[model samples]
Target: MAKEYTVTPWEVHGDVDYNEIVKEFGTKEIDDSLLKKIEKYGKLHHFLRRKHFFAHRDLDIILKDYDKGKKFYLYTGRSPSGPIHLGHMIPWMFTKWLQDTFDAPLLFQIPDEEKFLFKNNLTMEESEKWATDNILDIIALGFDHKKTSIFKNTEYAKTMYPVAVEISKRITLSKAKAVFGYTNETNIGSIFYTAMQSVPAFLPSIREGEPTNCLIPYAIDQDPHFRITRDVAPKLGYPKPASINCKFLPSLKGDSKMSSSINETCIYAGDSPEEVSSKIRKYAFSGGRDTLKEHRKKGGNPNIDVAYQWLTYFEEDDKKLEQVYHAYKSGELLSGELKEICIETINKFLSTHQKARAKAESKVEKFMLRD
Candidate 1:
């Protein structure tokens, strides 16, 4: 029997089976043929080559349009409920590559209102503050301000509210409840939030007064919202937005996606090098044998080892990654040594990122779009 797991926008736990998710969500797997086709347009980023972005919907169609001289823009966003974590960086990093490769315009949405309404403990003020902080991290990734437009929901309400109303009318309460698992106790704002989320996918097409293709790079958990959006797109006379979905970056504790709720399991972008080192050493779950003799005889299982698993995302060089994988599997590398490598890699990345984030303090206005 297959392992049982749960994956939702608000919650992710258990041993996630990506194949099951793709099948259940009714999305097509990104096959080798698609990767070759993508390479013809622009350099295939390592993420695509490695299948980190493993599943997609209508990607081939979007590329088909691109080949025929029809250009498509990109849309991806963050819900600023807390500080940005390393897991949060995964999609954005890949999105940045897409922007560069395609030379496409990007709209980064900060759905502060959605987050504030959904999380009881989060105040509007807090969500806005987090939104500002989150934007800084996004900017640090070096998105072109000239081609990128960032906006918080509340700030862009005048533009979005009218579109949202049109969507809300099309989606019935029954549909919303089924898609989002909403209960009668669920807030009115929360039910209405999906419509707001759907607006960006169709917003560009409406503004241009032409059918504009849109590609959304997101995690698999966010599929339901877009499923609703895809259904309503034809009704609104817009081309359905296409999306590429990535697997979750696992938590340090193992078998779970990294989340902000568990501070120990997550590595925040703002975390100090010392903190990164400390967390990996103290908490990252290991897949090594208990004793040295046993470890040498049995070898480490990289499949369950958090440190080795993380390297798959962080280490871009395939040759280097293979060396590490084999070294650990043969017990030539100890668990502590593997953790040290991860510590060094993450700390090095964050050290440079922190500097960019600090510099981003002044550049925020360049990316923000509003009245």
Candidate 2:
């Protein structure tokens, strides 16, 4: 039986079966044929080669439109509730590759309001602070300011609210309830939020005063919101937005959440080497045998090892990653040894990233989209 799992905009957990998700969500799998087509434009990103971004809705159409000399833009965003973690970066990194590869403009939305409405204790001001913090990390990823427009939903309300109003008109209460599983007690703000999420898909067309194609690169949990966006696009004289969806990065604790407050559950992009080391050594689930003798004889299971799984997301050197995988499976690398490599890799990445984030502080105004 497939493992019990859930994928919603607010929550993602369990041993998610992507194949089942694609079937249930009515999305097309990102097959080799699609990969080959994408590879022709430029070198295929590892997210595609590794199949981390494994499902799509009309991705082929986006490419075909590009070939016909009708350009498309990219749209993706974050709901800034807390510190950005490694799991959150999975789709952003892929979205960065998409922006670079296509030379396309990006509508990067930071929907601060979503979190405030969803989290009872999180105030609007707190969410806005997190949005600013999240934007710095996103900028650190090297997304071009010229091609990227980052906006917090509240600050961009003048432009977004009117568009959201149009979208809200078409989506009935029953549709919202059915799509999101909303209950009687679900707040008015939360119910109306999907329309706000849908606004960016129509932004380009409205801005250019012409029909525009949009491609959204996002994680699978965010797919339901886009399903509604795509449904309403055609009626509004815009092409349905195409999307490529990625899998979540697993927690250090294995099948669980990466709460920002818990150092052991997830690795924040801003974490220091000591914190990273502690988390990996103390919490990262191991696939090795319990005893040294048993480990040497039976070897390790790299497939289930949390440290090795993280490498699949962050370790870009294909040959080196393969070496580590085989070394662990053959017992040449013990669980501690594998965790050490992971710790080193993450710390190296963050050292460079933190410096870039610091520099991004001066460049925020250049990227922000406002009145």
Candidate 3:
């Protein structure tokens, strides 16, 4: 939520090409072997078997526990830096899906404390507003309140100091530096970020006085924190947390990642239909050439096209998405036409989510203060 620079699609991969990441680690293509293994030992639902989630570390163990009627909770946190965006929904959506399918308890943590550390002047009013907004957005993703728990770190920290101390004692500054690329110059607040993250992973068990297992669905960028969490889990007398690392969602401008800080780089959940249409027409990157004749003669660069990639993730109608891709690649579809389709699709999605969010907001306290 920290207002960072919106990167372009070319910059999304840094030195690596986007397609290479897709080929190597992206779950665009489902592997039969992996599917068979999961089907044999884990839930073989479409979301898992179809590779909607691509990479995981030790998730099989959590699934194995589930198969045996043991419980493993889901843990995911957010930094309340800004209004929720499309990038913000990825983890929550996947987590909600997992909760529904596995019937697991889900814990959602709002790292308002982390945001406060990064922005020292952040007021309690601002923190509460951001936390409330984020909760509404997450609930709109269709999580059941009965199975889901939400916490604000500022609230949790009142009695969680002991757990923080325990986590800090288990991890060293040297180890944190190595894992998080922290230099001697790194802020002390940032250095302690790992312990804050670790506390929530273990808090349920500490409060319940019973061991709890946790699984996190998060972006790969956050892997470092949980790596430390896993290492600290055993020493704290709890099971190590499992994780499923999702691929980064690319920006509409074809830059690094879709960010809400730059209005042109992303379509927000609150965007009006006209705003969505205008942004897509004006800012969405096009793979087609300036001239239709030239575009027809040469194939399009699907990798650089933002609309195509966005469709890959958002469009529920697989056949229609494929048709759009085929038409665009073959030069039968114009960039404007494709952009129009994306705008409509996104607008429809946002409209539904906004309505759902209103209902969710009414019951926010019920989930937040739950045992």
Candidate 4:
């Protein structure tokens, strides 16, 4: 006879205080010294001057090497789980800027194997399509084809199995479990996912037979993965991959991170201008109260308002953003007017990306497959 299963109300329904999670894991602030250095290095435009990308490890060492004319490469990847959302763009765009500013070689990988393992029901054809779309979107972010290389794990695994095997051998199961929160109940494939990700960090050097170091710019949530990579780096005969942790880009619905699973929570790079406007208008959480009278007396809460924060990143014109902030604070502009600014800003941003994405789709494969 089959075993019986039981369910409880707590299992079916429960609420987590995500705000506490954000406070614990997401609070980051930048220093004046770093900002000065960024401006001096002509990186002010390249990097977002926000508190989110403040925490880092061994970044100063990379900067020292860069100062001495030593080359440092970039490594960042995506699992190809779904359509690439705005959250996905954070690292890619930042990497592109870093590559352009420092003239560093970059490796962008599509973790097809990991995606396949995690999402077992997804077909190979579907994986390929997602990878293709993601590559197009990434390339549209202004990565040079000659300077950037992309790897698809499923395709490369055939040729690079020996390297993968060697990497897997060096990482103990105990270490993997500790680093990734894996338990006995975790899938065997999930246990080895870290090795799959680590190999690409050392690939440029492996392929060239030269000493190589890498800098990964990624969201803070992904720091755990690279912490494992950094620990296993020396055992694999390479320098530990260094990383700069970026803050999570909040969702339209005010979550800490935007997820592709949530339809109304994010605006994608591929969204039509009209779609972009509609989503912002309909779903953007308002900081003001329902009554005009109460809103005029209380003033808007800039800290919790999604529209204001979106402007901080999207609105290039500082004067306009300042005007909106002042108006909202003084009750001169209502929530609808503020959302219009966000919609217009987002539409303009997406329009530029769409044109580039069209050209990118045709050439992205060749760029990824390059030697």
- Model 3 ranges with Cα > 4 A deviation: 1-32, 37-52, 120-124, 207-210
Q: Give one digit per residue, the lDDT tens place, for model 2 in 269-360.
A: 88888998998999999999999888888889998899998888878989999999999998888999999999999888888888999999
Where model 2 places Cα greater than 4 Å from the true spot, the runs are 1-3
**How does model 4 fare in lDDT?**
0.73
Q: For all candidates, what are the clash counts?
A: 0, 0, 8, 0
Highest lDDT against the true fold, candidate: 1
Clashing pairs in 4: none
TM-score of 2: 0.97
lDDT of 4 by residue, 144-163 (tens): 88888888887777645677
User: Where does the lowest 10-residue lDDT sum fall in candidate 3?
Assistant: 3-12
| Model 4, residue 307: C-alpha shift (Å) | 1.4
Best by TM-score: 1
Candidate 1 at 285: error in angstroms?
Answer: 1.2
| Cα lDDT listed for each candidate | 0.92, 0.89, 0.74, 0.73
lDDT by residue for model 1 (85-177), tens = 989999999999989988899999999998788888999999989998899999999899999999999999999999999999999999999
Alpha-carbon shift of residue 228 in model 3 (angstroms): 0.8
Any residue pairs clashing in model 2, and if so which?
none
Which scores higher on lDDT, 3 or 4? 3
